[model samples]
Target: MKGVLVLENGSRFSGELIGCVRKGYGEVVFHTGMTGYQEILTDPSYAEQIVVMTYPLIGNYGINGDDFEAKRPWLTGFVTGETCDFPSHFRQEQTLDQYLSEQGIVGLTGVNTRSLVKMIREEGSLKGYILPANLLADGEKFDFPALPRDLVRRVSTKQTYQHSVQGESHVVLVDFGAKENIAGALTRLGCRVTVVPADTEFEQIARLQPDGIMLSNGPGDPADCADLLPLIKRLATAYPLFGICLGHQLLAMSFGATTEKMRFGHRGSNHPVQDLRSGKVWITSQNHSYSVRREGFPAELVVTHKHVNDDSIEGVAHSVLPAFSVQFHPEACPGPQDAEALFHRFLALMNERKGSQLVTTI
Candidate 1:
């Protein structure tokens, strides 16, 4: 079946519909990852956007249940240059088209995805729609549902949840729409995890007596979550705090720092980031359109990492607090292992803090 993707800026692309033959609307963005389409599609962070994969061929390895970061697909649509019809990986369970179509998610194949990516890079993420002409007319602009401004709220867990409480080290994950693999990463590092909603009360965590608190990656403008700043500020004072992606932005906000939207959001598996403390560079997986502004950061909060390409603030740690946050994902689901060591770093911090607390108590 044929489908038409109409952008708010009036650009249209026609392609073969491979996924659901349903109409959908969302903010259109692009990712440059060579692999991991399944993980990307299922990541809760991409909740309100249509993803365009810049890679020429997708789904070569096929889809499997194991790689999904969330329980289901969250995106408005998917546009790809090419989508594999027959997959070859041993773990492959189904083709990309079959999986998406079953989920009722729209997907467009054989699109000039490179051109779409270029447009997003130049014009930033924009609202768009995907639909069949029977349900919607081609090139006709409908009152496309607004791309959610409160993306974090839409994706965040409604109630506090827990997993793997059997481990020795107790960690409370403040789920600002955290990806599931992040919890898996922490469990692998010996953390007994208690996952909570984004605006969870600090007293609730105090009752649990956790050893560390993790601020998780999420979506939308950080300013919308202003109510969460007080909770983050209170929790960071009592325990080691580690943050990723949108969690990083909120941490900065909690510490009198500011965040701003980027011209074009970073949404790929291979972004280069530099560790300011070690002078080392690592390829990172990133998916955020906002970043912490160095100029607005408080003097006590020091920048710990920077983007190699644009020198944007990639990570920050407080000078006097056992708190830190990174703009890139360390729990790479569909990306390289170059940044995965950060999980060990968090584990080390937890160990060191526990040892110090024991000594003080003794």
Candidate 2:
């Protein structure tokens, strides 16, 4: 069926419908990665959003069984310049079109994605709808739904789950629409991972006897989770903590820092981030619409890393507390894995803390 993307600002773009033939609506944003369509699609952070792929040709390698970051795709719609129907990869299990159609996901193809991305860059991400061209051309008045404030609640797990690695150290992960690889990465580092709901209380966490706490990446404005900040501050004080993406923003917010939405957020695989302490730069995978503000940066925290492109705060560490965070994903699924070593960094911090406790007891 023919379809058109109707933006709230009266912008309309037409394309061919590929998947489930129903209208799709949500915040429309673009990603600049050349691959990792599967990871991008399944990431819970993309919940209630319509993703536009900037790369001209996507799904060339096909979808594999191992690459999904979540059990299901959370983005409301998928938009691309062209989607491959016949992908060529040894591990390929299904084509992108077949998977999208099977999953009841609505996708628009043969779109002028470059033009669409250019508009988004200038005007910022917008809430929009993908409907049949006829329905749009026929002058039907449709009320687009406002972006929901409870995106994190919708995507977060209702129950705590364990991904046991049988390692000596235990890390409790506070899920805020977390990606699967966040747990996978931790387990691979020889850490037993326990995942809890976003609303899990600190007392509940204290019972888990975690050596460290990991604040997973999530969606929506960090400020919307004002209630979580108190718990986050409490967690940081008691445990060696690490935060990623949304977690990074919340960690800063918990320490008197502020956050603001980017005009066009970072949503790609090759973002360059510089480590200020080491003068090292790493190509990172990032997907978020908000960042910690430099204006009211908390005195208790020190800037550790920054984005090379925009000078946005990328990493921070608390001076007194053994807590740190990074705005880019260290557990990149279909992207770079260099930052995966950050998990070991967290483990070392946990070990150091454990040694200190043993000494105190002695």
Candidate 3:
């Protein structure tokens, strides 16, 4: 079977089909990681997006049971220059073709990925469609619609649920298309996690009596989620809060900061970020297309981390509230673990608050 990727700008790239032969459409974005295809494929943050893998060879190690970042794949489609049909790994259970087919994801291979990535870098992310090559016409016009703003609601847990019940500190995780690793990291730190929907009410969360609030990474433009800013601001004042990726942008905007779209955005595992306070650098895993802007900055929030490449803001902390946020994935499901210590810091804040509350009640 053959397929073609048609971008909204009328750019078309032809390739052979490797997985489920069907049409897929959504925003077209790219990832720069050399490996970790499994985790990227299953990440909820890629929902409503067709992912172009910049790495030439994908699925060389194939798919394994342990590496999925979510229960299922959320990306609209997958593309690559080469798809490895035969993989060699001790833990490998299936080939890339088999995994994509099983997950019902459109897989197109043998395309000029470098040229495609260059177009994306120059023109920015574009909406696209993966269709059978036979569907092409002599002249085709493609118009891309705005992606739905309810992506968080579509991907979040419809009902609140507990990931685990055995831990000292209680954390209510606001699911803005959260990855499984976020909860896993907290559970490993002895925190009982209660996963809640993005639209969950503040009164409902207060009933849970959480020690801290964890705003999860999500997809799309941060401005589209402006409705949540007030809730985030309230949460910060009430509990120790840590935000990641989309959550990071939302947290900053709640404090009068703004966000802007990047040219192509960071979607790699090797992004470098420096802690401004410590003057220490760490390699981080990142997957977002929007970032907190630096112009007309808010004074109450301090810049705690910065991107080593373009000097973009990577993290921020409220001046008085026990709240902070980072634009990278410290859980490191598909990247380095250098920033994993941030989780420890969050737990420490929760513990400190608990001690203060105990003293006040006495």
All candidates: CA RMSD (Å) = 1.7, 1.3, 1.5
lDDT of 1 at 4: 78
Clash pairs detected, candidate 1: none
TM-score of model 2 (CA atoms): 0.97
Per residue, candidate 1 scores C-alpha lDDT tens digits across 140-251 of 5476565567777778788877878778789998887888888999998788999888777888889988988999888778888998898898888889889999888998
Q: Candidate 2: which stretches are off by over 4 Å?
A: 333-336
After superposing candidate 3 on the true structure, give the runs of residues whose Cα lies further than 4 Å from its correct spot.
137-141, 333-336
Which of 1 and 2 is ahead in lDDT? Answer: 2
Query: What does candidate 2's lDDT look like per residue over 268-301, in tens digits?
Result: 9899999998898899999999999999898999
Instruction: List ranges where model 1 is wrong by over 4 Å.
Output: 134-139, 333-336
- Which rank order by TM-score, best down to worst? 2, 3, 1
- Write down the lDDT of every candidate, Cα atoms only: 0.86, 0.91, 0.91
Name every residue pair that clashes in candidate 2. Answer: none
* Candidate 3 residue-wise lDDT at 130: 94
Worst 10 residues of 3 by lDDT: 134-143
Candidate 3 lDDT over residue span 196-297, tens digit each? 999898999999999999999987788878898999999999999999999999999999999999988999988889999999988889999888999977
Best-fitting candidate, scored by lDDT: 3
Candidate 3 clash pair list: none
